[model samples]
Target chain A: MSIEARFRIDRDDFTLDVDLTIPERGVTALFGPSGCGKTTLLRAIAGLEASQNGYLKVGDEIWQDEQKNLLPHQRPIGYVFQEPSLFAHLNVQRNLEYGLKRLRGVTPKVSLKHAVELLGIGHLLERKPHQLSGGEQQRVAIARALAVSPAMLLMDEPLAALDMIRKHEILPYLESLHRELDIPVLYVSHSREEVARLGDNLVLLEAGRVQAMGTVSELFSRLDLALAHGPETETVIKAVVAGYDEEFELSYLDFSGGRFAVAGKRLPLGSAARLQILARDISLTLEHQTKTSILNIFPATVDEMTYEGTAQITVKIKIGSVAVLVRITRKSASELGLQLGQAVYAQVKSVALLS
Target chain B: MFTEYDLAALWITLKLAVITTLILLLIGTPLAWWLARSRWRYKFLFEAVVALPLVLPPTVLGFYLLIALGPHGPIGGLMETLGGSPLAFTFTGLVIGSVFYSMPFVVQPLQGAFTAIGERPLEVAATLGASPIDRFFSVAVPLARPGFLTATVLGFAHTLGEFGVVLMIGGNIPGVTQVLSIAIYDHVEALEYTQAHWISGSLLLLSFLLLMSVYALNRRFSVVKP
Candidate 1:
């Protein structure tokens, strides 16, 4: 099943008009800068924005259409706002039960105990909201939403209100939730690192419009998209832990592109992991260098090339079935006479391991 | 030094304050919720009308209410047509006058409390499967507890001390319409200083205790909020 949404919202300064069909099982990120209407689109899908002429379908259920409009409470959706928004009058346990009590006769798919344990808030059940720190309060807010057993979850910049330290404190819980839950998630965020780490499908929004939509790996490496040429531009790759070299303390991850030797033995064999390879860390060579210290060297075919300003050039290359980006100086490109479809070797410096 | 009439007047005053406070809470809740949440451009006009009793002289409000409740006026005329006697100079007339007189005392505090809550809690409640009515009772009411205490005390105390409105609409009947304030007036007019001092002192003490409890309770409640 998939979610189909069509919304047209007109405001004084901006308008959001889009049609999207995203997968219903994994996290689909509405990625954009501030004021680009990513949050508005999420709110519209949740039935909070009151956008007219909108049509929304989650799985087989029609949440909104021309003839009928469900209110926010009527839609079976769990929403996490930018703030924790825990009820000040209630203790943490009562706050968690607030939604569970309203479920009427519907059988709860997510039990209250499971939500509490998932967020690691079991010890805070007796304390009031004022007693908890910012990160703890946000955890309670998330658990409260989950206790309702909603069909889908919508999060609007959930980490934007916290500092870097607090964000780190809560991200693990979020990652585990993504791993364990079957409910689909619509995550709205402007942070590129967050999108790269948590998102499975990416919906790129620009100026209140859908610029592009695809799997995270495809969009991140696409040369024409805005994600390709920036200093922070990186390609995401899905890999499986092949083996661990206990002597060198290295874990070998095999992807469609090639095998990567990363500096860790933490990942268990046969587990899945994500890798982020920055474009600047990669250098193109005409032949394999045997005298080099670099451990990762893979033969790739150049698929596309684009100039960055006057000095640097970004080249897209295909290694087996996966696409990766490599940035080299324009002088090097000209001296080597690099052209599209040319066979080359891509040298890697480092990679970030994401789970 | 208090007479039997003074005791009777005290009963009538307490009865009026209690009934008026209850009525104000029932109606003032929805009114204050609207004032706090509505984005209507002309809302200030309605707010100004609720606050008129605060600035206007009590006698001026009493005069208009006296006219409105009299036998020939609109409200009294409607009652007469419905086969009931006119409300002027009755205990019910005193109640109507007190509700109008003490409106701002109840509504302003409630509206301020509701506004201070912000919209985040209610929206969170909605996402958690609370209907509008359910949200009001479950979230809004509990969060606005301090406001409810303030509104109740202010409305009841303000009604107890009313003199001009009661004199005009209630006509100061001995056992029926005469309240503590009018009774104290009668004692002072007859040069009965002891009886007047006794009643006035009781009122002063009662109002002080009510106000003190609200401040004490409000501070405790404020600590629970972030």
Candidate 2:
């Protein structure tokens, strides 16, 4: 399914002008720093904020047009604010039922029973919002939004208000949502780690403007995009289970950069997984070193380079059309005489297995 | 010993306080809600006017209202033309005076409550598909219950203690405009200390009980029951 939106909203201090479109199913993370208008765009889509000119089409349905502004409730969009914001007067059960009752039809996209199970909040149904812990409250909030059977889910920094421990507590439920629900989610977040964990697609926003948009791998591998130039710059590679070495207790993850034998991850055989390799973790060597114990290596060609700090340069290397970043000292570049068209061997120091 | 006039005065006081408190709650509620939420630049003007009676010597307000509701005055003449008698020197006059005198008591508490509620709850209600009015009634009202209780108690007690305004406008008509404050005044005027003590003591007890209940309930409701 395809979603298209072009919106221009003006406020006293903040003016947002964005044009974006996502052409398929997946969790598209709206990633940016604070005050980037991520929440504003989400609000505009939800009809909670009126824009001067906004055109939104989700799947086959037109949700908004400048000529016709649909009210928030009229548009089947579920929004979770930064705060859990459950009705304090209502028990968890009633909070879930609040959205269900709003639906005029007999059939619901998300059944009450299913939502309780999905968020795993059935046990807390009778408890009030204040009675639950922060994570529990957020889960109830998510369940409440899901009960209405929304066409698209708009989550605005749903985890920003939680403590680190609380955020850790609720992340798995979000992972489960991506696995179970096929509904498109527009998730707004400022955390790079969260984006790496959840987003199938990425929209990099900066000061009310779209810096870049593409699949996570595309955005991360594009050497020119600012997203690929910073400390968080990393390539997200989609890999499938090639095989496992039981004796070594390592699993072979096969991707375009060739096979990576990482510590044994419990993922089922043949299940697709996403791996994130940080730019800083990658080191470049001109020759295939036979003495080093570096377990992962791939042959790559130097494509481009950028100076990061006073003494270091970030090199972009391409492997079979796959781009990965490597951080090297200026001394090494001078010693190895690195430049464009130079072939090298890339070594990864560490990799994270994304859920 | 209690005379027919004493009993009549006590009855008038109870009637006036009850009727005035009722009318204030009915009319002041909408006004208070507007004052709480209106973003008009000149909003403080209306707020000043509402608070005038509280600062105005009760006699000054009563004097103006007396002229306004008198048969020869604009309001009284307007009422006569509308097929009603002038309110001057009548039970209706006392009721009007008490409502005016006690308005700030009711309006202030209710306004404070409504303002404290802020826009979050209402916005949440709207997103949940509640219409504007439904949100105000179902969400705003229930959450503002403490304010209502405070307003009711203060309004009733303030009206009960009203004296100068009632006397100026109502003229202390026995069994009609005469209230507990007026009755107590008459008893002391006649040097009947025994009778004055009973009426004044009873009112003191009533106002005290009402205020105590409000504070106690407010304490309980303030914890924000989930």
Candidate 3:
């Protein structure tokens, strides 16, 4: 099942027109800059912004059609705004219970106990919203949304109001939420780091339009998309921890492509983790070299190549089913004679271990 | 040393203020909510109408209310046709006049509070499964508590101090239309300076306390707002 949405909204200064079929199972990051209607689209999906010309369907349920519009409260959705919009009058426990109490019909899919535990907010139940820290309040906000057991979740930059430390603090809970829940999450964020870390499906929006929509890795590797050109350009790989080399302080990650080793922290064996490999760190090789200090070396076939300005070229390389982006200089590209269907070795790079 | 006549007048004045404040809250809340949320181009017209009592002379308001509630007037004529007495110069007529005179005091603060709440909280409530009415009571009302305190106190105190409106519409009748302000006037007109001083002094002290409490509570509430 998927979420089918077609909306056209006109305002005094901007117009948002988008048609999308977002996957219903994983986190779909609405990645964009400010004024891109990311939050507007999220609000529209939750039935908060009433669109005159709109059609929305989540799975088999028709939330909005030509003749009828379900109100925001009528739709089974959980929305987390940028700030922790908790009920100021309520203590943390009551705030969490607010949506759960209003739930109608269907047995609650998410239990209150589970929500409280998932967010790690058991100790804060008695305190008022103002009494808690900003991060703690936002955690309660997330738990409150989950307590409703909604079929879909819409988060409009849930971490935007926090400091760097707080964002880091709350991100693991959000990652766990994405991994633990079966609900589809439409997460709107402008932060590439957030989208890369948590998003499975990415919908890049630019100025009220859908610039590109694909898997996070696929979109990140595309040379045509501006997302691939900047410092944020990085290939995301889903890898399971194969084992640990205790002597060398290295952890072996097993993906479809092959085995890769990284400086080990404390990740349990066989647990899955995400890795972000930047394009600049990757070097193209005509032959695999054994006497190199670089630990990550993978042989792959070039799928496509695009020139970047004058000096460098971005090559999309396919290793098994996973795609990796390598930025090489023009002299290197010409010397290696890199072309479509050419077999090449992508040598060594550090990977950002994101779980 | 307040006599039975003075005590009765005080009781009637309290009754009028309390009833008027209650009725104004019921009427003003929705009207203030609308004024806070509505984007209609003509909303300022309704705002101006609500504020008419603020700027208009109390006697001028009394004049229009007298015409409207008189026997030959539309409201009084309607009551007469329905086999009830005209509302003119009755206790109920005094209440109606007080509600109109004190309306701005109740509505303006409520509107300010609701506007201060902005749309985020209500929108958050809606997404959290609260219906519009539910959001109003469960979220909006509690959030606007300071405004309610201010409005209630202001409405009650302003009605207590009313003079010209009650004089124009509610004729001086002991234990009925004769409120504290009107009774104080009666005492002064008869050269009873001592009785006037007692009533006037009590009113001055009471109004001061109510306004002081409202200010203090509003500041405390604002500081505690989440």
Alpha-carbon runs more than 4 Å astray in model 1: none
lDDT of 1 at B56: 88
What are the DockQ scores of the candidates, in order? 0.87, 0.43, 0.86
TM-score attained by model 1: 0.98
lDDT of 3 by residue, B48-167 (tens): 999999999999999988989999999999999999988889999999999999999999999999999999999989998999999999999999999999999999999999998999
Tens-place lDDT per residue, model 2, A1-355, is 6999999988888888999997557799999888999989988888778887789888888878856767776788778888888877778898888877877774777788888898899899999888899889999988888888878888888999999999988888898888788788899999887888889999999889999998888877776777777677787888887788878877788887698878857577887778889988998888998888889988999999888777988888887678887777898888989999899999887888776
lDDT of 3 by residue, A61-156 (tens): 898998889999999999999999888888999999899889877689999999999999999999999999999999999999999999998899
TM-score of predicted structure 3: 0.97
| Best candidate (score: lDDT) | 1
Please give the TM-score of chain B in predicted model 3. Answer: 0.98
Candidate 1 DockQ, CA atoms: 0.87
* Clash pairs, model 3 backbone: none
Residue lDDT tens for model 1, A102-180: 8889899999999999999999999999999999999999999898999998998889999999999988888888888
Segments in model 3 whose C-alpha atoms lie over 4 Å from true places: none
TM-score of chain B of each: 0.99, 0.96, 0.98
By lDDT: ranked, best first? 1, 3, 2
Question: CA RMSD for every model?
Answer: 1.3, 2.6, 1.5
**TM-score to true structure, per model:** 0.98, 0.92, 0.97
Q: Which pairs clash in model 1?
A: none
What is the C-alpha lDDT profile of model 2 across B139-166, one tens digit per residue? 7788789999999889888888888998
